[model samples]
Target chain A: MDSMLSTPRAPRIAEQAAQWLEVLQRGGAEERKAFAVWLTESRRHVEEFLFMTAVDRVLEDVDPQQRIDVEHLLTQGAGKVVPLPAERAAAVSAGVDRVEPAGMRRRSVMALTALAAGCAAVAVAAWGLLAGTGWEDYSTVAGEQRTVELEDGSLVYINTLSQLQVRFSETGRDLRLLQGEAMFSVERDPLRPFRVDTGSAVIQAVGTRFNVQRRSRQTTVSVLEGAVRISTEAQTQEEGELVAGPQQSVPDSGMLQAGEEASIVVNGRITRRPIAEVARVEAWRERRLMFRADTLQDIAESFNRYNRSPRIRIEGEQIAARRFTGVFDANDPESLVAFLGAYADLAVDESGDELVVRMK
Target chain B: MQTESSKQTDGLAGTALEKYRKDLHRFLVRRLQHAEDAADLAQEVYLRLLRVENSEWVRKPQAYLYGVAAHVVFEYRMRTEKEPVTFDSEVMEQLAENPAGVQPDELGDRLGLERQLERLLGTLPPTHLAVLLLHKRDGLSYEEVARKLQLSVHTVQKYIFQAKARIRMEWQRQEAQ
Candidate 1:
């Protein structure tokens, strides 16, 4: 049935509505006058516009189960004449479900990659289906750090060059640390346990403070507050077993106590170490990065988190092996490098906007 | 609302500087949605203005100050990798409940009308479309559009009027078809 909006004056009325919306978005006195003219152009124009807008308002307000006819709407473009198809009516409904699957389960690694490619990951994932599963996505570009507050009130502070995802439900909070490091301050939610999936294995925590670093196939978990249970798909049965020895069942799965670190290699080998100041490992929250006796290469890489510029290349093995420790604000890395050059007798050379560290 | 000249003079003596500073900061905070960051950048703007060698070049002081703030915001966005800063869907859903008392029937009709207008807009030639977008989308005045595109005001107005009439006719034809 042709509606009231299907009348001959429909287009003019629609134009009037578009004009008003435009004026509202870009407010100007003249635009306001034009909008007023559109409104008072004719009684029919006014009535039709009101009718169409009311339908839109209803589409927005009513049952979310209503489906949208995106294909029909795409064809109509922005015209106001034809009645909204079932798809158009349900467009908002479908959009709501689009976010659920990924948000519900593990956000696909491909989803994160698409996100890095400047595609709207959340929006696209909300609108369309993602390719891969079991991969969580987390990303912070150079000189950028992000903190994501989980549904359970736990905060995850991601350091630079990091991407990860946390999928939490009544079952548990599962995280896929795709790449980079994240310090998690988990809230005390005993019912829903927290687990981080680092491709190879999972780091599960129940009311714990810890940091997880994922580099390619290798994953590291450092505990600070409460104890964390690091397990693989194999060790799920041995709930009470403290598989401490090197050649235990799920090769790398082990328990890490407070101030302890654990690394899992690709071949399922796990190593644990003691860390004194866990704050140094999770310094991204305070906007300060700390490096303890790291190689010059590691230090430079670390500095890249704070300062994106200065491609520092240590000259010889001697200089590259030299260790240093200093505190720095996230924005400034120039003085830190300069200070090193002065003390170590190394030359700080600027070659095409890049700071090179070599023998003087 | 003081004169630009007075504001410029007051900026130097740090007299009205506090008030201007607060107003500009508030303006940016609302626009950017970051209070602390806005205040920091606002301080930078004032510092730059104070340090400017030719502050008197700004005839329209409020416009110039806004222009500077806009530029600063632009530069800040440029310096950082773009993050997805989206409106909260839940909040938006909540806001959609009443939508500031906009009549439902009227809003629906307007949406349909908007769609038709957009379709009509698509049918225009590139130049006509540019004129329409600049005039309507960008809200550029006839004179401003002419200045921006290096055309006369008459030419810009003609393009706009023609574009509007053409779109109106196209709508009529589509309705008939």
Candidate 2:
């Protein structure tokens, strides 16, 4: 009787929401009127509709580059049985062979094998494998963050409004931090050194954890663990042209160890210093921003990356230059506005889309 | 008859504005995150409602009023934000409170949500997955997807609807755990 009964109430509501979603997408005055009636029938209808809409929003983030073998899937009976495409299978096999027989590679292989047993698991494994073979672009929109795990066991923590490109070859693992910030935890492969290119600077690491941020015409690299060899793009290019043998030393290049930071301008100027607060440099990974004596203008710029509405705008130079020291949630710009509003000399206007700050 | 319907529409808008103004303002404030902007937009919703041509056809003015409110908010964000708008913090908080909705930990992280989507999409039946990918990921219309898949447009719509409902139910089941 339970099996023969009608569908559960929750699923029935979900089905109704799905139908409404289709109707809403059509965008007619008549359909909208109907949707309004359906939506107001019960509070549960409204909640279910919002929930489904949220799920649809999440669907937009699915990688557009993902390629599915529709023909193969359809021929295989279109159920829980998904066969790996020919090219993806080749890629997986090629990866298994080229990867060194180290503990890390073995662990990665074991994980892949375990996932490969499930019908859908093969698709995920194939996606991960294919990402390693060629240049793939990974990016986060405004107010979003992403973590990408490369085939070589490295992990990239991409900050909001950032773009990164990754390419792995037999001899080297290369990454380009095109814009914004990224923290890389590189897996060790002495044969294929990890190198990140930021247009202005090229950071070469054998095995290290580092963060690179590209802002305007400047690129800042901070080492969290191990060491990295940093060189201007010009110097590396010149070294490649002149040096015939394995170049042991690169001219105008510097080595930075843990706790060291380097800033390279577009004009090949390099500045090195010890990081004042390593935790602050790493705070974005945890969705919190830590600022120490940072100007309001800079803080506003940072918060703007995570929020689109209620933008923070500094009205006066005095207010823009006011230094603040505190930790704030990256997603909550209102908290920052409230904090500034508490000050005696600062005025915060929350009446508009822009939270304007000025001298009282 | 036309004039009488227009007058009825005006009356409907007037009464609905008085009844739902505060509720509309609160709703806008939750989504727009600014009380002043919400207040301004609440007025705009009523103004737009008064402009509707088919006022007599609206049997439930309250539903239509809230519907117009949502449309106004959507248009305002699309004009100003210039980026894809996700669930507002209020909606997200409400969803987090519901047991059948996505967990807070999964909702807060974009990467986590993405990976969960990838895994969830993998488990879908092949035809459902193909239809979903073609429609959502590729941005193909139902007719275009039908032509490409050699299925009727109605079948395509049914597949998409079924896929979405399946994913939503599965997501709820996962979150309930």
Q: Chain A alone, TM-score for each of the models?
A: 0.55, 0.60
User: How high is the CA lDDT of each candidate model?
Assistant: 0.51, 0.63
Candidate 2 local lDDT, residue A133: 56
**Number of the predicted model whose DockQ against the real structure is largest:** 2
Worst 10-residue lDDT window, candidate 2 chain B: B1-10
Local accuracy of candidate 2 as per-residue lDDT tens digits, B31-149: 32232353355456546555666654365444455556555665576768787656455642332233121111222354556666777787788888887875665445565556556
Model 2 pairs in collision: none
Please report how far candidate 2 places residue A173 from its true position, in Å. Answer: 0.8
Candidate 2 Cα deviation (angstroms), residue A153: 0.6
lDDT of 1 by residue, A203-271 (tens): 776555788888876888888655676776533223222222212335445767767898888776788
Worst 10 residues of 2 chain A by lDDT: A238-247
DockQ of each candidate, alpha-carbon based: 0.02, 0.11
TM-score of each: 0.40, 0.42
